[model samples]
Target: MKRSFVALMAFTLLIAIIGFSAHLVVLEINDTHGHAWPYGNYGGFAAIATIVNQVRSEAQANGWDFLFLHAGDVNTGVPESDMLYARPDILALDMMGLNAMTIGNHEFDHPWSVLSRQMAWADFPFLSANIVYKGTDKTVGQPYLIENFPDLKVAILGLTTKTTEYIGNPEYVKGYDFLSPDEVAQKYVPMLQKMVGPDGIVIALTHLGIFGYSEQTVAGTPGAVETAEKLDPPNNPYGGSVSLAQSVSGIAAIFDGHSHTAVTSPFNVNGTLIVQAGSYSKYIARLDLIVENGHVATYTYKLITVSKDIKPNEAIQDLLTAYQIVGSGKLNEPIGYSKVNFANEKDSTRKADTLIGHLITDAVAWKFKDMGVQAVLMNGGGIRAPIPAGTITYKTVLTVLPFGNTVVILKIKGSDLLKAIQWGGVYHPEDTGARLNEWGLTYTVTPNGVENILLDGKPIDPDAIYTVATNDYMANGGDNYSMLKNAQQYNTGYVLADVVKEYIEHISPIESYPFTPRWTEVK
Candidate 1:
């Protein structure tokens, strides 16, 4: 009897030890934006695959439960990937063994047909709990995925930013509704929790962004802080990942994207962990968690730069090379040359009027000059890359403007035009993508609003009817340019990239344009 009792005790203790302790390693990347190839030693899918394989192998060797997730925005940015409709990226991500990815606004850059085709090509599920067919409960993709391990179960719920309704191409996203993230999580978290059972972890894989770390309210959008704190209605209009963490009881962590923010360390908000790996495939975020009694007891987080130092994975590298060869055949044709570089970095163009901004707006205005288009307006977000000094090619122009937006002429009242300009200039001009670039008009941004608005060197008459050239995206009210939504619009049926290329070609050996600032700011 004594021997039997001792043996029983030993068995019970071993069971407890095995059940109560476990190791989990999660690798995440967000907003990759079609960087399947390396940019001068910075980032590429091949390098990312090598890192993922290495870490996955390490995890297996260490007996840790492993997961690889993408927070979203895997499309757009690179002409090589864009030309192929991001098929190369989808294939490479599948080869890398991606467990899951959320839907990003850029996923809708192309029409639904393209997105559906990409979805069919991908092995892993594209998750989004908040996107649904209009007036229906049917979700566009899997709402959440449950992964079971030896001693732990993890439920990942995907949430996309609500801004997709206005930020995405309207025609492409017409039939889909971007439901409130918090509301969707509220409905899903409890169900997920019940499924995972006690001690299991629930995480939000989100595309919602952090607009500003210091201010909860930036450009009238609720950021992570505001969302977490549950600010008033006007302030907390759009709930983000932080909001999901705070409002939902069971979520343990959130991996987020869409503001291109690189969170160096995990943000602990309301006992939930939030992290973003930034954009452009530049970094991979790794989180190591220790699970005790089915709950996360401790963790360590870091952002690893995907630099050229790492050897590329052979298979992924070969796949990307094949796609590059195909893409290069059409994109490499030289169109013109620039005497000086035109800067269009996100930070530069989005804050102040830039040379590239001028060039693009000028191109649009020039295209419709015969139609009596007096001025041009463009959203800085539409401009993606800088035009380097030498050897401009079709690839170069396409890289700068990949959305394929068409030039639109709107007969808008001058009052409404001023409103649009003010909305762009005064509303968090520093980071908002809606910041405006102009041609044939000049304005000064003031603390109150815009002042000294001029068209053709004369003050804009409020009641005068004016023809303004802008992309179809904005004319269709993209980027929250509501003032232009009701205006009379005529689509020129010309792709903006082609128009810019033609303009550059026409003005080849492009050395200097009017350098006078089209817009200025007052302290």
Candidate 2:
């Protein structure tokens, strides 16, 4: 009887220990894309810092653990940040006390020299477990970071999308191998679990995206949901955060980027909570978790909009202001004016021909008209933003074309061009970045393939060679357009933004341009 009573007392003690709760607050931002300054009264490093600081202070006062994380893509998108090699953005993040960040695909947009320099400038480590030097096990950056709290330890692992190999600049990422995230996670997660012990939590910080197979039908890249569910072939051709969650067993939650999704409520997949804040620093995701007996017992999530109501942090604002002033002087100079808005919204540009698409392609066609370039093709994804009707500045032009890609003229047989057009229109009616925007050509998108192919109003002759102008990205097989890779090529060495700027200046009062349907879909 005495021994039984002792066992009961011990079990009661265990239950008490398990019931003890610890509070943890995590703030995450993904795909900032160098919008350090607020636009349209939403998002800015200064404003983001203010909210982060407040949360950090509150957590400190309450004896709760706090973490501030960025999911990646800190480079590109803004002229002020891009011209300075994202110095201001990195400095501002450092000042904001960012704990860690993932290495996004866009990080590979420039040469290794630029990325290496940017890495050296940041205070926090850039994490990616699957990105390894070619033919070696060596990683480009820290794979995961371990943070210790009074009650438990947290393991944060970083995984980038395998699509980086193709979507990222091929020239720059040639030295690295983007391994499948699921394979890497399966290998490392168990090790992380053992290191953290049973009670500790393992979290995935990824740039793998959250869209499911249906959303990315053509690309066959699975999102967090598809990955988590482990959808079969054609749906989840490439693994994602979701796959990691299902394939591996130790992860408590996942913070992801890449799809630019605004996950208002956390997605609970295979007992793992997944969250992603929309891109461009427009939203900050706050996750408050209650940990008990080494597991997440309860949680709440909110995607905080970086509205103007939130006052900007003075210190961060001052730092960004200096850089902004330097670039603003040249970028803000009025270059031209537009009578009507040239819409470049992602869905509009990718699904159908738009005015902005026509304007950009027309500019390219105009620049190389003397070179006998018959038509120009620009990837819909390349048109980053819209040009609202008003004064157009160099900044506006740069914002639209931020990749610094030069123009390339290719000589290809009409048959090859048809393949390229068909590939571009394969995902018609559905938004895809690979869709081609054309000038000086028109075609019909049929269920089977492209038809009515015409160049300058004449039916294209399959055996004839045609001169086509496109960006260096496409000429080198970017966006999976491999048809043009082997074609005869001439690199013009002119920055696309500068070309567009010159065109805008020459056509100043930019009243209108050809808006004819470049491609029509026939169901």
Candidate 3:
């Protein structure tokens, strides 16, 4: 009887110890497009600091540990952030005390020199396991980082989206070759596991998108069943985060970004849990894990909204105040008022028409009116964010047309013009340089073919030569618009954003330029 009682007591003791062994809090924020200050009570870096500090304190009080991580895309949306070369955003994040972050595709939007400077400025390592320096095997950023706590050890491996090569400024990423995340994972995951042993947890902090942005039926698009086990990142990893979690083992969870989707729950696939916090400094994703015997015994995911109710961190708030005083004074000067919400060029531009695109193209056309340019062709890739319905600011203009592209007029054969329109329409569903949004021209594009090519409301003569206004990027054959490579280029010194600013200020109370179905994609 005593033997059985002692055995039962030992079993109960084991249960108690297992339940109280270790508590780990993983805090994540991603896709924070430079929203350092609150906009109508939503999103601010001060609030994020408040939440992080609160969570960290709470975890410590409970005899647990915490990690603060940012996924990617830290800047490039707000004028306050971008105009100063993302300095405000970078400084704010550095002060917020982030443990580490992965490199997003947008990080490559600036010059390589600028990227190098930002990497140096950061307090934490910018992680990217797959990105290798040009002509060398060295990883550009910290391929992986290890953190040791009293009770547990954590291994973090970072991977940038392969799309960074194309989606980012082509010129900026010319030297670096981004390797496959899957191949990188196969090598690193095992090495990490061997180092940490069974009790440690391995995590993939990746900037690869969770899903394709558009779900609208794209005509002439493929519908084949793809899986991570069979297909590589090159063959369509179908949202690299989900794909890798399904295929790779030993990864406890994936903290992901680039899609801006608020993933609240722990999505279990094949044994791994994948989660992503929403974007724009709006929410802090808290992933809690109870680790024992080198395995996650229990886990929970929480998306803590950065609402106004949470008191802002005083120090961080003060720093942001100084930045806002300068940036807002410059950016907030009301240029005009808009009659409509200039939507983000995500879903609408991918398949159909968007007023924001029209406004930009129209501005470009009007800017070169004296030059006798028959039409304006603005590459959809250049349109960054959308304008909300209301008072428009210079900041709004900057955010809408962030890239500092200048106007360059080109002379192209009418046949090549048709090809330009066809090129933009060809990659429907899949975003590419070919998605040309234009003004002073109209065309109907279906999966079958292009038709009704009109220039100045007249049928385009395939052989007639025409002067066309386009951005310098496209004229240089960015996004595979190869036809314009050898065109007679007429350089216009006007910056695209400045042109847009002039157009808006020139016409106050700017009415919603009626979005006629100029570029129709028949699904």
Candidate 4:
């Protein structure tokens, strides 16, 4: 009689579930970079909201649970958003009613005061488990948020990329150390297990990326070493979002960001779904899950392109339009024109010099020549975008040099400079951050070290002190350039973007600038 009763109860539950079909839907967007308007063919926050609302409306009509999530980097790109301290993005996200978000590296682009104020305005929780108060175990931001759907509860863990310590503006991220994602995952998953139990879904909403690191040895390449040591950082700590997910148990999926990838489908690893949406709000990631008995039974995914065809939310569109009118007065002012197009792709800058590299480095050296600056060095990773042929505006210059680092004049011996360059270039081509873009000196960079460094058609004097003009980022030992950490430095009090814009305006119709042949293979 007991067995019969148990079967009857099971049948009744199944019948109930079948009668009321239910689903869990997760909508994700990542690395938005403040493209809140239709950028050429890519994005507009109004359209994004429209699509999101439509999807939600349909889901609700069908009795499905819905969650709208943003991965990170919703700021620091478009002039309309960035110039106003990224408030447009915050306002738009609030209007859209974002459920949760992971704090991205760009969140630290502004000063702490500004960042704090911005965070205060956000409607949803900004999450990062690994980012802690300096020398303390407290998170710099909220660690995670929980969403309870009918019959199932999900705990979403948030982790920022560990690279923010050195890669972001140095002063902004000072005194804080980003803990390893693996350690963070190991620390939190156990507690989460107690809270959510075995049947609940645990999702990691992380900004740590799948940065295409490979462990397999490729001849004469540093990528593998970086991958191995990076995968398991110092103290044998785990690194990257994937490593964190693979190390921890019970995580059902990881909605990842920071690489600016457009993953059309989930990258499944060890039964966990790792997914990323394209950067700049180009697409919205839709993850559909079928829950059975308080557990995810199966899932499918799609990336909805924020194409021009979609209608935008009228309110958001009006707000963006107003902001654009207010911000565009000077930003849209034509600075100059360049007839020649120059590639600034990271690989191009790291492997060999491009015209854009030459233009920036030359501008730095030329702008500060009166101070006896011998050469100027900027990181290849610093060159954010290519200088397109034809019209160039103030906004264009800002996008290229967005960090707002000041020109730092430093006195350094050639030997120490070489060490700094070599240290920074330890993983050239494979690592763009280490590739030094410079003017007033031409050097052939190899995997082994820097050689053939020329100054005035002569070899660099190792003992002689030379005046170097570089952004404060490197002068402050950013990107692991330890040798540059203690150099005799002077703050020029000039923002890098202003200097670049000035140069462009001064040299109005720039017809051509060729490669000075930096980063030779030296075979």
Q: Which candidate number would show the highest TM-score if scored against the true structure?
A: 1
lDDT of 4 by residue, 1-523 (tens): 9999999999999877664334789999988887888888855899999999998999889878888898888768776788888787888888988999998988988787887888898988999899998999989889988887775677889988887887777778886888887778888877886787655667888887664632111221244324433444332242566576557766778888887666665665556677777788888889998765445679988888899778889988888888888889899889999998877664466545667878888888889989999878888777777778999999988888777789999999888887876665445423456677777776666656776768766777789898999988888777766687667999999998899999998887988775556556555
lDDT string for model 3 (382-501, tens) is 787778889988888887777778899998888888787777765544344357788888788777877777888999888888999988777766676768766788878788999999
Greater-TM-score candidate between 3 and 4: 4
Residue 79 of candidate 1: its Cα lDDT?
93
Candidate 3: segments with Cα more than 4 A from true spot: 1-21, 212-239, 337-347, 385-391, 413-416, 432-434, 457-465, 476-493, 509-515
Enumerate residue pairs that collide in model 1. 199-294
Q: Which ten-residue region of model 3 has the weakest summed lDDT?
A: 216-225
Q: What lDDT is reached at residue 378 by model 1?
A: 87
Clash number by candidate, in order = 1, 4, 3, 0
- Model 1 clash tally, residue pairs: 1
Q: Give the higher-TM-score candidate: 2 or 4.
A: 2
- Which candidate model has the greater TM-score, 1 or 4? 1
Taking the tens digit of each residue's C-alpha lDDT, what string does model 2 give over 402-511?
A: 99999999999888887888788656331367888888888888887888888889988878899999998888888888888868988999999999999999999977
Ranking by TM-score: 1, 2, 4, 3
Report every candidate's CA lDDT. 0.84, 0.84, 0.78, 0.77
Positional deviation of 463 in candidate 2, in angstroms? 3.5
